[model samples]
Target chain A: MKTTNKIITNINQVSVDQVGIGDRVSRITARSVKNEAKIQGLKMALNMIDLTTLEGADTVNKVKQLCYKGMHLHDAYPDLPTVAAICVYPNFVGLAKEQLKGSGINVASVATAFPSGNSSLEVKITDTKMALDAGADEVDMVISRGKFHQGEYNYVFDEIAKIKETCGKNVRLKTILETGELGSLDNVRKASDIAMYAGSDFIKTSTGKISPAATLPVTLVMLEAIKDYYYETGIQIGMKPAGGISNSKLALHYLMLVKETLGDKWLTNQWFRFGASSLANDILMQLEKQRTGNYQSKDYFSKD
Target chain B: MYIGGKFPRTESGRYFTLKNAKGEEIANMCKGSRKDFRNAVVEARKAFEPWSNKTAYNRSQILYRIAEMLEGRKAQFIDELMQMGSTKKQADEEVFTSIDRLIYYAGWADKYQQISSSVNPVSGAFFNFTVLEPTGVVTAIAPEENGLIGLVSVIAPIIVSGNSCIVLASESKALCSVSFAEVINSSDVPGGVINILTGNAEELIPHFSTHMDVNSMLYCGDDKKSIQLIKENSAINLKRIVIKKDIDWMKDEAESPYFITKFTEVKTTWHPIEKIGASGSGY
Candidate 1:
């Protein structure tokens, strides 16, 4: 039976006077703490994308399997595990789109120059169009690192805006502000503002191409930008810290910054997502460890 | 949730663009302000009379209703939390803590008086006694972190004591706080018993602290400026100020007892036991 006030009265009668106030406090604290600990196990979930670091045709099947793995495992764990989206080049968008058909998880394609933003605007737009036409729900577009570094921020902004305008509300635009190239927190903040002003749907930390692309500070800066912008405009932008988010504890910390910085309204797939090749299984392993207090199968995860 | 008949969060969510780890757009949060905070206080003050005057048994039921709403919407709370960028685990904790705070407070409405006070020995002949009472309108500046629980911890304590509070909530985490207010509405807190403001605290604190009519102010924030403002505004009318130190709120401390001390007043009435009879018997 659900406990009633009568039950509470009975509970109150339980020789609490014999229990020191400290002990009662500790006892109550433990229950909440245990709940909090269990919650930790569930929250650090990630969408793992094992970038084979491959090119073109070789990427399709691997992408398909990763999507399949995500879908199937998600069927088991439901909300427990995030099906890391299929991260791939523009050409394989069709394959991933077809293979992962009907799977609610994202088919995120790398566009706007992919790993490098060295391409012409025409080529970048075409790549993004192809990916969108291929059923990519999210477009992870790399911003022009050279142009941004050279401080041609407006150009980068225009390009991202064009991409966003082209994606036209159907596809979410994740503008990658390669932090390795952005140089500092201020730049990260500036780039984040530019991307939002330019109409980018989400501001991602890296294209996972550059070294030191996704650091805690960079992500923190980006999240702060999203938060500040939303506070200013009544619009909430998503935050994704791709690459190097390999540890569950780190992921949890990221969640902390996001939670505390943004508030609970932004805590969802729509507001928060992580992009990494290795974070999912690690988080899964940790969650399993938390559940049973023993290590479980890491092999179950599709090698990210 | 509901404040002054309308649901509101503490922050005036000015910043838009909810980004994901990959940087995506999520949803919109309000840009709350100090005016809103003060307005909430106004509502709480208005709501205080009937609510405070309600028998303790009724207050307990209303608080219990809040606990029920919190429990019922737990999942939505979790989902909203995720979008706010909390991991599933962290989201779960936020939800659990929120619900627990309500349930914890619900238990205190009827029992706090039993905990913090005892009969005072009187030198006079009449029945002299003391009891705690509500401090009317109050203002609270919640902590920057632990969005849901922290907000709950402040608002619940203030209202449980029958004082309505205008609170400034964590701006970033206003979603749950917003939604939690709906829970309060459903739970039966009279309109204005708790009002929340969400935005730059600097902008909002001065108004609430210095408001001439405010009866008390709670300083729950870490910034020194908030303290200075609390001091400055409180001086205008000498509002009873409570500067809550940052302690491990994770532990219960059974602090319901403290609320009794905060809101109650001692009453002593004197009556002589010996004299009258003998005067008539002087014959």
Candidate 2:
């Protein structure tokens, strides 16, 4: 039922109007979400965070601190839900799992040479297995941008499918397009369709390593791709805008985009996540401000 | 200029002309809007941590660097001060005193901690001592009198103690502040360490007091209504309000290390000592 030829045929039919997308995104962002809806959106945004720290200098203590922070985000605000997951490097997956044990917080490990998919297929499989062996609930892998740029769409599709297969049915596979390197929105749409058809559980925007990681326009194109894929196969996929999304206002705009394009079913953490480290604290600060009717200082909050 | 690191024009794209005493237009300066202040505060907050965490010696060296830069541009400062209705003698004195005030505070930067902190005598088995810490971001309104010296006097103490500040220059005499910002820019002072804005104080003071991110405010002018408004609005975050009025900045008493203490917090620590049981050493 699934073939590289079919994937190419479907993607070739997909064309995105860049000018129209820009106009629509601007209009969408201009719609001000206020008061009650804002509070609700803030809480929902807080609950859907991946609370990530994927720096090269990550340590066991840092992962442990992040794992704890994911569970107890701003203890000052009672009844707040812990973040959906803790995203870390593949090496710290076991440490995060050990720290976040029984907390219902999923541990997501990045693989496939992470942020760059220039390694051999054999290495990618082993990289994914290392995470799985360390109890990672989700595996975020990158597609080979060099191959994708070379017009080898089949190679990219097969690579995602192989990683998805290795992830088994239990672990979700999030394919990082690293869209900043992909150049135009047309390439983004094409990459999104290929990643989806190749069996990605989630299609991520960036590895948080590149500039212009996640913009509303880019996310809109990917969401439209997910919408078209859903109509064709009746399958649902998650969307994550990682990196540089460090405030509540932008996160709320992304939520509004999701609800409008993909409807309410995709609003929960199961379908949406923010791949950010500092975003959690900013969200917490906003929530506290809402409760106390005052602005918050960064000093009161704990660092992850 | 001095948004983040590089010198930039105000984002509002508005500029006001600074006129000489003879009513001739001297120069066009950035008419900083609320947006510029907001941007500067963001940079100040960003620079606060590293600027605060630096060794007191490093801050001293930077403050001294500002004085060195100001001394080299002494002629330029004197000319700007004279253009704003100051006599050549007053302009010369203001520039000289401003440079001296900077050196005075630079001397206090590394030594203020030892002078103000104290070890407390506790009755129990505990070692207790109180140390001073910089109060994050401070916002000040430079006095209307003595533009160069007043601006330096208000700013030096706050930043010498390692608190980053956004200052509102004198409403009428703003050219010197912009020139001073250039001096600060050339000096090794980090961007956002000192942000100077030229604007109406009444329009900007409310924001200076009520901005949720600003930690402390230094009001150098004695406008009763403005002070009242600042006092009332600053209650939202319980911001520290330091109202300085009627004191001539050129006075020798104004150069005390105590001015540095105004923008600092005394943090007392209790370290547990080895506990002695009821059984004595003889027993």
Q: Which candidate is the best by DockQ?
A: 2
Q: How high is the CA lDDT of each candidate model?
A: 0.68, 0.89
lDDT tens digits by residue: candidate 2, A1-304: 3567987877677679999999989988888777788889999998999989988788889888888899989888999999999999889998999999899999999999987889999999999999999999999999999998898899999999999999999999999999999999989999999999999999999999999899999999999999989998999999998888999889999999999999999999999998888988888887876787555677778987
Regions more than 4 Å wrong, model 1: A1-44, A47-57, A74-81, A297-304, B1-283
lDDT of 1 by residue, B1-283 (tens): 3468576543444643344445666656555665465456557667878777987667777877887888888899888778767789987876777668777777888787776555566654444455567888887777666667778777777877677777777665666767777777676677777776656667767777766557888877567777876887676566788887765444575245575456545445454555334455321
DockQ, computed on Cα atoms, for candidate 1: 0.01
Residue B261 accuracy (lDDT) in model 1: 53
Q: What is the C-alpha RMSD of each candidate to the true structure, in Å?
A: 29.9, 5.7
User: Least lDDT summed over 10 consecutive residues: which range in candidate 2 chain A?
Assistant: A289-298
In each prediction, how many residue pairs overlap at the backbone (N, C-alpha, C within less than 3 A)?
A: 79, 0
Candidate 1's TM-score reads 0.44
